[model samples]
Target: MMISYADSALSVLPPLLAITLAIFTRKVLLSLGVGILLGALLLTDFSMIGSGEYLANTVSQLVWKDAALNSWNVYILGFLIVLGMITALITVSGSARAFADWAKLHIRNKRDAKLMTMFLGCVVFIDDYFNSLVVGSISRPITDRYHISRAKLAYILDSTAAPVCVISPVSSWGAYIIALIGGILTAHGFADAGHLSVFVQMIPMNFYAVFSLLLLLCVAAFSLDVGPMRQHELNALRGNLFDETKGQPPGATTDLPEADTGKVIGLFLPIAILVFATVYFMVSSGADSLAASELPFSVLGAFENTDVSSSLFFGSLVGFIATVGLAIQQKVEWSMLVKGMVVGARSMLPAIYILLFAWTIASVIGQLETGKYMASLATDNIPFALLPAVLFVLAGVTAFSTGTSWGTFGIMLPIAADMAMGSDSSMMLPMLAAVLSGAVFGDHCSPISDTTILSSTGASCHHIDHVVTQLPYALITAFISIVGYTVLGFTGSLMAGLISCSVLFVISIVILHFWAKK
Candidate 1:
């Protein structure tokens, strides 16, 4: 049965409330938890009514449902744990500091430092969270040496991370797109079967993501400074980067600060291994075959069910254990080793809490089928000719609100494909590309986004500060994207739209550059 508007609204109410409360109160974790509990209560109340036994059953069903064991949840948790462990290892060995120091020796100018940060961000495009932490840690010292404000550094990191991944045909995001596109095709009655060729073909048509990438490169090349970014750049030029002694050394309190150098190579070994293993698995699994998979199990089986996050988690666990053993081997005190682990874990506490709450809220919404309901509503009211533009806006709004492009795509792609089937227009490719592009656009700008948060944390900047500074740049890129998508919808030519948008983006950067110089 179709869900009624009132019921759908009720289903979405908890998440909206949570988001509002989080924004208003500036307490993310608490707000997320409250939202999850509210959803749970609503679901239970709707089903159980006045029966105490049924209420208990509903609560149990909600808490212990097999639905919670979905692969995405497992992947997220594994990724977080691995990230925590790897970060700890990096902190303990001081590899991050060693890398930072080495970078400072080569990068002598502010522009060079900023460019290097952007370059690194692009290199680690596989996962936005990984890019954020690695880029922030390695580039922080170099940017500091050049007096680049943490805010500006964070802006660059945030801008590059998700946008790069969205356009890249490799990475975790790539897998998600393949899955979403396959589902979309089936829903639209496309006979292409299980292949991801359609998605691959649409990549070049993702005007927003492609243009956003160009914008980042242009900003880096021209050194364009706009809005709050201008103030940040000015502060950096005046030699006021970050005051390390202000709050607490990241990952350490004032009373129990550890030296920045203990065992650099030992710490980086695990992450290196993880990179190697991920590459090796991807290669061994036959990249083309995995990309062509029809179901989750096909991809899983290709990799022997060894997901990257799980592999990294286990690798990190080993690395941490080995690092601790090495400390013992070097006659370093066990207490010191334990202290490092504690400090590292503590540093990750905020990220961990955010992930937990984000996942819970996402799960709650999924259970209530909020995305499906929204998709139905959109398809019903939106016209065929306007679907591409409207889908772009809808995807953007969902992504911005949810802070997860994958989640937004998961929700919208099927509906968009279904809508396209009924439309008289032959703009399905354009519409699909718009959805993908718009989702990343929103994720790029959202303050609560994991990538956004990680970018700020990585750059050693205040999170809100990074958000404020980067907003103008992201909005500018988004504006260009909107115009580009509009052209593509009318003309049905992605190539022309992309070319036009790229040229305009480059010109905008050039103007901003000259203005910044003034």
Candidate 2:
């Protein structure tokens, strides 16, 4: 029988230890492995036999859950492999170089380059994974031409992805959250126009997501680079876009050959196809899911029920075919084509390894009930006025420890709803907003987070460098969000809270910009 550690403080140890080690060592796989082993040990009460069995279950959970195939994990991994190959093919065909050369004619300055990147990041809000990877592939050449650091590119990619998705009604994150919130609202006997409106209402109140996007714009428009990001930007100006010490980062195309005759269509057509195809597949998948449940179809409803992983897989497959076709049209040799495929897939191996370990450790953390233990801290004793702030902090801690915002939401949203219903039911929306803000903040900062890892991969930045450099920016936004939540809790005025957050965000950017200049 599996043991339950939900009530024990020991539940938090493994993730804490793992995260700490990862920060200090910069060894992601090692850190996650250590955390997983420790969690297994704790779940088994330090018994060898029990630990082995517990670990086996965790591994099983990674690929199979409840005797059913875990298509999400499998399809996501497949998508990564295909994406890597596509990235490689784009380079080997000289499409990347062609794009860079073409961008140079139009994008005259660093700021424009960055603004374009941020713009793309916002426009591709269907899914965080798609946004991060596709935006990285497309904008990388332009940003690279302007000497933008891979770390900065990764930061922008990371910032725009989850924050945008959390607010976008048509996104995978929004769909999932709306469905989950519908269940929570039903359970609490709260009636409204629908879950979508409730989610839309919470958008302005999602301080972290709102402020983080604003901060991204400030960073690009005003050159408000602060903390580690400032140093990375300086290094890039010195022609060090990547830390040579870390060796080649994932998605690096240094080894790939570029054809002199490569055209811009080689780059644009493949990615364009990828984006449109992915959207098509996403809608098609959602329609099938909705039909299975005998529900009427709507675009938002389709997004809510979409199979994101499989959609990404099929979409990427189509993009890969387009990429190969373009390469052949460019008269690329058969051997080079094979080489691009091999090298592209190989580049993703490191990311895939890190993801597997991260997933396993996350599974272990779940089995240990780490999120439940964290949620257990915000008891009935917290003041009604402070519920939003407290729940925000709790949700942040849970997401940071668990390295999964969706998991954090699954654990905390219902709890927030229940607590608000028991206390000041009027505070329910703010409390729910707090959880969303905090979870995104935590997921944004966690080194083990899949989006974080993918952001690094997409920008071809070293994972540790991406994690370390983005921390200060994410923290600042998080700090502003907490203050906003505190204001909302105390004043019961969303406007007051939003004004507070907006003012603080602007002030922080101004201060940081000046500080960074020195």
Candidate 3:
């Protein structure tokens, strides 16, 4: 059923209910389920049978889209499971422990641990999912050895993932946004504008992304742990990496068997292969897509057309095979190999459940036209000088409510372009950039976000703990971004906006330092 409640105010209720309940109750699955049920009921006009059918169809689409078994959601879920199994095999082969022991020699303090993790997060900017899980896999041992909290590690992963991806033109986010910008420009008669150049131009205007990364570095360099993050840091320093009361997080497999001897090569080789293979596949997939289209082949064009879900799955499968090969080469018991794969698959069940629920609810919200409703409210009767600022806030709220930045980008970008045309054509870039920045900001804070959930899973931290601790930092960056976008809107100077954000960020850092001392 293709239904839209875009004109109805009730369109906003389901997501609001879910987000509010998740934050307050800290019961993510229950909250999402309730929201999904309520949205389905609303869509079906409160008919129980209709609602059930709606939900079943939505869930079924996760694996079957267009009556095909191959779906992006299925590929992503498969990647997670394969990656989990690789992680387990690495553990069983003793590669992870050996790598950790090697890291301990060089990462001598908590600060180094933090910075290393941040650096890794930034370097792996091809995709947020890749960044979150792989960086967590690589950095967890070092951070844990230094008594860094999983919450803090997850915060680093979360911050670095989307912010970096949003700004980096080579990333999946970059490719997607560039493609959107291309269509929007064509629609507005800027068909001659180079999409890549346009994306690069807006990079600085993406104040939320630029500043969120700056804030992440500041958090690491100055130990600027505020809000819930402060307590999490303190607890970590006191030898508690996670809240035992919350139980083991997804991917925290304690009963997995380990070999008596292992090599660091076991860890590095698989990760390197995974990263390289994934990138290669991404480019190859993009090339394949370009070949089928009328567009000329270019590296940027390739990325803009790539199938990221399939690439991740292929890459993880290769990595899993490498891990298994290494385990066998190490004379790891066959029984241990079987146990590791089984345990690894089991470890991802919680995350899989959450992903399924989150994906389904997101579909329901789409049916309800929640983002469309929110976008409508902000695009009307807005002053030209406030367009960028207004769009930033609007995009943030839309993404936060929808729990999907890409969806927000799709909903808001054309709307932003249309609004900009009515005001000032030159303001288009700033407005579009604001939408991107705000979407990333909202995604960072949204509990139902896949990146947020994966960041928690990667660090094996309580999901709610990661969400709560990361919110303050995301909010601070968002506030600075609002100011920056406002300056850009009024002055039409991207530099002015950049300066405004830079000054505010420094001021915020100083305040954080003094407050932490107090």
Q: What lDDT does each candidate get? A: 0.65, 0.91, 0.89
RMSD of each: 4.9, 1.3, 1.3
Would you list the clashing residue pairs of candidate 3?
none
The lDDT of model 2 is 0.91
Poorest stretch of ten by lDDT in candidate 1: 248-257
Reference-based TM-score, model 1: 0.80
CA lDDT for candidate 3: 0.89
- TM-score per model over all chains: 0.80, 0.98, 0.98
lDDT of 2 by residue, 23-46 (tens): 999888898889988888887778
Model 3 lDDT tens row, 420-495: 8987898889999999988988888888889899999888888888999999888889999999888888899989
Q: List runs of model 1 lying over 4 Å from the truth.
A: 1-13, 20-25, 33-94, 186-194, 232-270, 278-308, 318-335, 377-383, 514-518
Q: Give stretches of model 3 more than 4 Å off.
A: 1-3
Clashing residue pairs found in predicted model 2: none
RMSD (CA, angstroms), candidate 3: 1.3
- Superposed Cα deviation of residue 261, candidate 2 (Å): 1.5
